[model samples]
Target: MIYIVIPVFNRKEYTKECLESLRAQTNQGFSVVIVDDGSTDGTEAMLRDEFPEVVVLKGDGGLFWTAGVNMGIRYALEQGAELIMTMNNDVVVDSDMIAQMYRWHREKPQALLGALELDASNKKPIFGGERLNWKLNTIEHLLHVLPDAERKGLHPVTHLPGRGLLIPRVVFDRIGLLDQKRFPHYIADYDYTHTARRAGFELFVNYDAKILTYPEESGERQIRSSKTFKNYYKHLFDIKGGGNLRDFTRFTLKNCPPPYVPYHLANGYARRLFGYFLK
Candidate 1:
């Protein structure tokens, strides 16, 4: 059976909506495993009272996205799930999303799957298959250039965002869980896709399976809002502030070519500095 794993931290309303959407899905052969990361907003209590069918796991507020997801993934594996779909709790999925992803997986049994994510407010495509340029250390998203009709077909991706990622049991068994310690927040998705690619697993995005999610704020916003050097430093280094130099360095060293590592690191620093000044 397919197991849906969601890692939630607060945002009770969004969580409720996400669960409701999942409950209304066309495919019923799935179970939900929610890892609540110490939400004090009555999320756990509400889930127990309203959504008793869900299997809830509690965390000590320390299990960030990666750890929380890892917890749910481990539990799903123990429960004999053939496929595990990890999604953010802030998104509303389409009714046939699971079925479509499962159908694609059945066709490409050895592939890792993802769905097109659209902006919840504007209904515009936000995240889909991305092309990574190792030489330039840049990523190009296909959402803007690819038309709607072309997006209906499966497309290969170098990296996928973790919002609506689907992984077969075999992929996890071969690659293991995401690197929680190294990438507690960001880059973990990129690392996972890279690891899977190294293991000869193809990554594909099924555009027909879609979800609506909020867009993340850009780094320039954070830089512009930093009023002091202290806050600037925090925004530059803190994981939650969308900055973690160590993790970024680790990802570059691990995945990037030896010669390109320094170039990428320099370029990243230069870009962020330029963004700070431009902001």
Candidate 2:
């Protein structure tokens, strides 16, 4: 069975809407797991009262996105689910989102990962997957154009937004769990896709299965960092830990050039200079 996993910290109304959408899925043979990350906003009680069929996993408030996702993914895998879908708590999926992804994978066993046409709450596309840059990092565009099937090999990387990523359990087994140390947010999706690529899997965005996403702002410091010292340091740390220095450095210099060049080059140099001191 396909299992859907949602990691919710505290967005009562959004979570409720998300679950409601799932409950109405045109494909209903799936189970759900919602990991409540120590929410004090009556989320616990609300979930118990509203979604009795959902498998609940509790997390400390500090668990953040990556940790909560890991918890839910592990649970889904252990439950003997053939496929596991991870979606944001604020997303309202289409009735056929899960079923379409299931069929895509079933037909294209080589396509190990998939995402949906994630539109905003107003029904505007928000997550159309990533555009590749062999030099630096992949760029994400929120549905710049109408939904159309992307040529399979056109992009070097296909990003599945955690908001509506459907991953087969076999892919998880091959790549292992999502890395929690990547700051619990931001880049984990990219990191996971790269890992899947390394493990002989293809990531794709299925235009057919679309979902609606609410633009929630408060919890994403990793993405909205204001180019501060700490943010730069964290960026360097991620490069060091998650990517090879030389390759990532070249990527930053060549693919991600100009305004972002000096900043990344400085960080790359600093990372190399301080390599001895970093743990």
Candidate 3:
């Protein structure tokens, strides 16, 4: 059976919509495990009353995205699920998404799978799997390079985003769970895919399977809007914030080769500083 893991906070409306979409999926051989991170907005109570079939794990509001997902992943593995799917609660997936992803996984059992993410407003591609450039020490999204027709089938990727990633049981047994302590939020997805690649697992994106999600805002507006030093520092260091220097540095140092680590660190800070002034 396939187990779907979702990490949620205070967004009851989004969670409800996401669960509703899941319930409408074409494939019914799946169970949902939701890790509710201490939401005070009646999210837990609502899920219990409305969606009783879901397994809800409570948190102390400290388990961020990575920790919450790790908890759900562990629970799914214990339940003997053949495949585990991790997704953001704000995303509403296509009805055939699970079926398509499962079909692809059956064909390539050793491959990590991901689906295309489209903007909920404009129906444009927002996030998808990417190819890593070892020579340039950068990554490029597949959608940017390939046309819609060419991207329809399965294609290789260096890293897959966390939004709608599917992992087989064997991958977990070999590589292990995401690093919740070091990469508690941002860059954890990249770190996981990098680890899987190093351990001889291929990453693929099934463009046929799509999910609708909101677009992330640019950091220029955020930094420009910060009126106080406290707010500026908060945005600068926030894990969800687009430009969290500390987390980016940690991810670079841990994943990049020793020779590229210093270059990446310096480049990351330099870009942020340049963007701050230009904004």
Candidate 4:
């Protein structure tokens, strides 16, 4: 069976919409496991009352994203799930998503599958996957590279974002759970997918399956959104902040070769410094 794992903190409305979309999927062969991490906003009660069929796992609010997702993934694996699909609560998937993903997985069972992300409002592609530009010392999302007409089928990628990603059971048996200790929040998905790619798994973005996402709610909010020291500090160190130096450093050190690590780090900080002033 294919099991869908979702980790949520609060935002009951978004979770409800996500669950509703999942329920309406064309393929009803999958089960859902939601790791509700200490949502004080009546999320647990609402789940019990509304989505009684879904397996609910409670957390102490500290599980964060990586640990919370890992908790559900463990349970899914224990239950003999053939595939595990990871997604965020802020996304409303298309009705044919599961069917599309299943077809893609069947065609390329050895691959790590990713679904295209579309902006909820604009319906334009978003962060589907990442490609490392070794020359520029930067990581760029494929959404910016491929146009709609060109996204015909699967394309090679280094990291697939967890928001609507299909991971085969063998990945868990090989790479183990996501690195919650090193990346409790942002960058964990990229790290895990990149590690999987390194471990002989091909990464691909299945253009057929897609999710409508709320981009504004992304943990990827840049520090340049504001010009304050606290924002800068969070941008560099906060667990929820994307491209934080600590987690990004861990990811690069673990993936990038030694000689390229210093260049990547230096270029990253330089861009942040320039971005802060220019913003």
Which candidate's TM-score is highest? 4
Q: Against the correct fold, how does model 3 do in TM-score?
A: 0.93
Clashes of 4: 0
Give the worst 10-residue stretch by lDDT in candidate 2: 150-159
Ranking by TM-score: 4, 1, 3, 2
Show model 2 residue runs off by greater than 4 Å. Answer: 136-156, 216-279
TM-score for each model: 0.93, 0.74, 0.93, 0.94
Root-mean-square deviation of every model: 2.1, 7.2, 2.2, 1.7
Which residue pairs of candidate 1 clash? none
In terms of lDDT, the poorest run of 10 residues in model 4 is: 218-227
Q: Write the per-residue lDDT of candidate 4 for residues 1-279, one digit (tens) a residue.
A: 789999999999999999999989999989999999989998999899999999999988799989999999999989998799898999899999999988988899978898888899999877667788755676777777877688857888878788888999999999999999998988889889989987999999998898999877765454556668888777667776664777777877887877787888788767655565564
Q: Per-residue alpha-carbon lDDT of model 3 for 66-98, expressed as tens digits?
A: 999999999999988879988989899899998
Q: Which residue pairs clash in candidate 2? A: 135-251
lDDT of 4: 0.86
| Global fold similarity of model 4 (TM-score) | 0.94
Which tens-of-lDDT digit does each residue in 45-115 have in candidate 2? 99899889989999877787788889998887787877778877888778887777777777766565455
In model 3, the number of clashes is: 0
